[model samples]
Target: MVRQIASRLFYAIVILLGVILVVSSLVKLVPGDPVDVLAAGNPAMTVADMEVLRERMGLNRSVPEQFVAYLGQAVQGDLGTSIRQGVPVMTLILERLPATVELALWAVVLASVIAIPLGVLTALKRGTWVDYVGTFVAVLGVSMPGFLLAVLMILWFSVELRWLPASGYRGSALAAFGQAIIERDPAVFWNAFRYFILPAISLAFVMIAVNARLIRSAMLEVLEQDYITFAAAKGVPGFVIVIRHALRNALLPVVTIVGLQLGALLSGTVVIETVFAWPGIGRLAVDAIHVRDYPVIQAVVLVSALLFIVINLVVDGLYRVIDPRVRDD
Candidate 1:
């Protein structure tokens, strides 16, 4: 297991380097010079000024030389200064990282809490109305685009019903909870939750649908196995048989899906964040792209790729825990 983990880590580093190199190269190919974009607000800036700026940014160097320099700085944890923000790229990312993490974690938690039961119920109910309803929900969730859903939800829940805030993030729930403990005020947490509800639901919509469908299918297959049949024949309670004998075995595939989706949610938040005006890393990346801010864009891409690699590694560890066969292999 240790050897396998080391091998995966080595591959992950290679993949991350490849991603960084490609992003750094392609960002330069984007039209409109970063120097020009930077100078747009300063009308007195001249051609000479732009040239000097380019030289300072190392844009005057050959691509290979620039890449080597960038790679060395990256290894030392310097992602360079943001062209647009005029701050360290890593600093900007760190500021927004918590919001993105909070959103993704909440979305996954909401999806799992809702999806698992729905899936199990649908499978157990089979041809009943409950099953039909669950299937319809799954289809709707799968078919609806997240942005569209986000818009419609804003209209209904935020604009019309006025139950939740339409846009913007309050502090994360953890921060709110900490403040609440310090001040003896519980409303802080509620405020954060209100701000979180719309975006979390919007982001989680597809995940819940997909997870439900996957779980339903896995449950159906597991229900037919001889162990389940024997458990039922031995007069085990219906709940115990379903939960222990069937659902536990069915969860292996669900675990894989959830892990991949969690990683995807990190990268997939751009649209949702934009629509909702959530101040997260995804929104930050989008803003950087408009002006072709290479440092910020490259940092975002590298960080996202690193997150995906880490999630997959964690999933591999989960496999061994969930199934003894995985350990043997």
Candidate 2:
């Protein structure tokens, strides 16, 4: 198991190196001078001045030299300062990381809570109205784009019902909880949860639908397997048979979906945050792109790529836990 984990970690390192190479090159690959975009409305800036600025920013270096310099700086945790924001790239990402983390965490939690059991029940009750309803929900969820859902949710829940905040993440849950403790006002925690719900749901609904379908199919297949049949023949309790035997086998594919979707959920925050005015890393990336903030863009891309790789590694570990045979395999 340790060897397998070590092998995966080595591969993850190699993949991250590739990501850094690609992410670092993204600015050069894009057409047009990012400096020109940055200098827009500065009528006094001359070509000479622009050249000087470019040289200072290391755009004048050969690609290989620039890459080496970037790797060297990155090793020391300096991802470069955002020309647009005039702040260190890592600092900006860290400032907003908690909000993004909060949103993504809630989204995934909501999705798994709703999808897993619904899927298992749907599969168990296949060929009935319950299954049909579940299928309809999955289709509806998958069909609707997240932005559209965000808009509709804001309209219905925020405007019409006035039940929840339409958008914007305040302080994180911990902060809210701390405030609750400090002030003896439990409403702080609820307020935090309330502020989180719409955006999280908007982001998660599609994933929930997708995960449900995957779980349903996996469960159906597992339920039809020889082990399941033997367990049934042994007169195991139906609930025990489903929970202990069937559910465990069915989880591998679902785990894969969850792992992959975590990255998707993170990226999807860009749209959700834009719609809801939530301050997160994704929204920061959008602003960076608009201003041609190369350092910020590169940092965001690399961070996201790292997140995807890390989630997959965790998923690989989960595979071993879910089925010990996977370790040997």
lDDT of 1 by residue, 1-329 (tens): 68877788899989988998798788888888788887898989999999999999888887778789989999999999998778999999999989998999999999999999999999999999999999999999999999999999999998999988999888889889899889899998899978888889998999999999899999999999998889889999999998887888888999999989989889779999999898888999999999878888988998999999899888888887777676623
Report lDDT (CA) for all predictions: 0.90, 0.87
- In candidate 1, position 75 carries an lDDT of 96
Error of 2 at 211 (Å): 1.0
TM-score, model 2 to reference:
0.94
Off by over 4 Å in 2: 178-184
Per-residue C-alpha lDDT of model 2 across residues 40-89, encoded as one tens digit per residue: 76878899999999998888887778778988888899999988768899
Clashing pairs in 1: none
Q: Which one is best on TM-score?
A: 1
